[model samples]
Target: MDDLDLRLIKLTQDGIELVPEPFKKIARELNISEEEVINRINTLIEHGIVRRFGASIGHRALGILFNAMCVWNVPDHRVEEVGAIMAGFDEVSHCYERLRSPDWEYNLYAMVHARTREECERIAHEISLATGISDYTILFSEKEFKKTGVRI
Candidate 1:
């Protein structure tokens, strides 16, 4: 990565401008062509310097008040199949498979967001019904301590 690439990263680390041509805007700022800006970003991604380049929505700002961490005690053999189903739900923003111990047998987790706790529960129920995995718990988030992407 060159200086221009560094500048491009710094410019877009927070977010790209909400313009009709965000890349063109960045190109102007970087004194490079729009294609170069896009190519640099693509190279960064291909090289795994940027694992993801996507939107980050603010659920609270959108009136999605309840965020629940739903944990499921999925059978060891079906963890992948069950996790895919859980991740497919629209309400679930994040799904993960975690190592469990004797103290905590829940191996699968998903973060579900909704306007209310009841909605969260309903979504959880829908997930349970879809996956046929009812041995689970939903822990609502009481507070948000941090919500930001990694800084370069």
Candidate 2:
């Protein structure tokens, strides 16, 4: 990546506009054409320099102040299948499998976002109905101690 690419990454690593022509605004700032910005970003993605290009919505800003981490005790044989089902839900933003233990019977974790605790429970019910895996727990968000984005 060149200096301009680095500058672009620094400027937009956090976020970009939600408008239709966000790249045009970025190009204006960089003193380059919108096409150049798009081309550079595409090249970066091709090389895996830019791992992802997307929008991040702030739950607080959207009045979605509540969230939950729904942990599921998925069967070993059904881990992948169940995880895929969980990930397919629109409410779920992050989902993955993890090691389980005697004390911790849960093997799958899916983070669900909602505006209220009740909404979180509702989404969890939908997930359960979708996956047929009722063995789970939903831990509601109390406070956000730390949150960060990717950096180079």
Report the C-alpha lDDT of model 2 over 20-71, residue by residue, as the tens digit. 9888888999999999999999999999998768775677899988789999
Model 1 residue 49 CA deviation (Å) reads: 4.8
**What's the distance in Å from true for residue 83, model 1?**
1.1
lDDT of each: 0.92, 0.90
Task: List candidate 1 segments past 4 Å from native.
Answer: 1-7, 18-32, 45-54
In terms of lDDT, the poorest run of 10 residues in model 1 is 50-59
Give candidate 2's root-mean-square deviation (CA, Å).
3.7
RMSD of each: 2.9, 3.7
> What C-alpha lDDT, on a 0 to 100 scale, does residue 75 get in candidate 1?
92
Q: Model 1: how far is 38 from its true place, Å?
A: 2.1
Model 2 TM-score, 2 decimals: 0.74
